[model samples]
Target: MAQVEIYDGEGDELLFTGQFDFLPRAGESIARNTDDYFHYYEVIDVWHREDSEAGRFQACLAVKIVD
Candidate 1:
């Protein structure tokens, strides 16, 4: 489970939404459980689209939960 969608173009979008379920510390790598949270995603600036030449642009990254 992993979702991070942010898009707020002045009344044209979403602000913030974060979901988590990405455990990749390998059972338990010392240092206080390594890391479990503190992820961020951003792209909220009028949708930005000046030809996007190599700027790369993609949204919606949810649905990815395996056991």
Candidate 2:
């Protein structure tokens, strides 16, 4: 599992955050902020960082608003 955070292109605003068993890959579209705007976002990039002490990996996803 991994954590996913969606933000604006400038990374100034956080759109959504959650944990997922499988993260969306680049180019995938996902509905976000459903409780508010119900906007769609496209995954732009995916990255991971190793947490040696925790013995796990953290995934970061960069996404952009599609509409």
Candidate 3:
């Protein structure tokens, strides 16, 4: 599984956070919520950084608004 953090088009405001079993590749689209409306976001980047000693696993994703 991977942790997904979604942000606005400008990457300013953090809109939502969730988890999924598969990581989305670049150009892929995924549904997300903003305010109360759902929208699709095109995957821009997927980063995985883990710290075994600290027991932390990070999965950061960058996406663009895709109506």
Candidate 4:
């Protein structure tokens, strides 16, 4: 397990940063050749509650391969 940083990489800005105990859904190859590959990813769940105008998003998923 490692701390994988999820960066948008569009405008050199950080989107959402969090600590995931396990790798994202599909994950990558253990082999050195395909080390930079990711098969699947999903936001399992999210919960937010505030005193004013709170918001919550749940089970958002995206399938993407990282290179």
Q: Candidate 1: where are CA atoms >4 Å away?
A: 1-3, 6-12, 17-54, 61-67
Flag regions of model 3 displaced more than 4 Å. 33-36, 50-53
lDDT of 2 by residue, 11-61 (tens): 646666788878889998887566577788788877776889999877777
TM-score of 4: 0.26
lDDT of each: 0.35, 0.76, 0.75, 0.35
Instruction: Identify the leading candidate in terms of lDDT.
Output: 2
Name the runs in model 2 displaced over 4 angstroms. Answer: 12-14
Query: Would you list the rank order by TM-score, best first?
Result: 2, 3, 4, 1
Error of 4 at 41 (Å): 7.9
Please provide, for model 4 over 1-67, each residue's C-alpha lDDT reduced to its tens digit, 9 standing for 90 to 100. 3344443333433344445565554333212123575433333323222334445322212223233
Question: How big is the RMSD of model 3?
Answer: 2.9
Candidate 3 residue-wise lDDT, 1-67, digit = tens: 6666765647546667888898778888898676899888887777666879989877667778878
Worst 10 residues of 2 by lDDT: 6-15
Per-candidate TM-scores read: 0.20, 0.67, 0.67, 0.26
- Decide which is better by lDDT, 1 or 3: 3
RMSD of each: 12.4, 2.7, 2.9, 11.1
lDDT of 2 at 65: 76
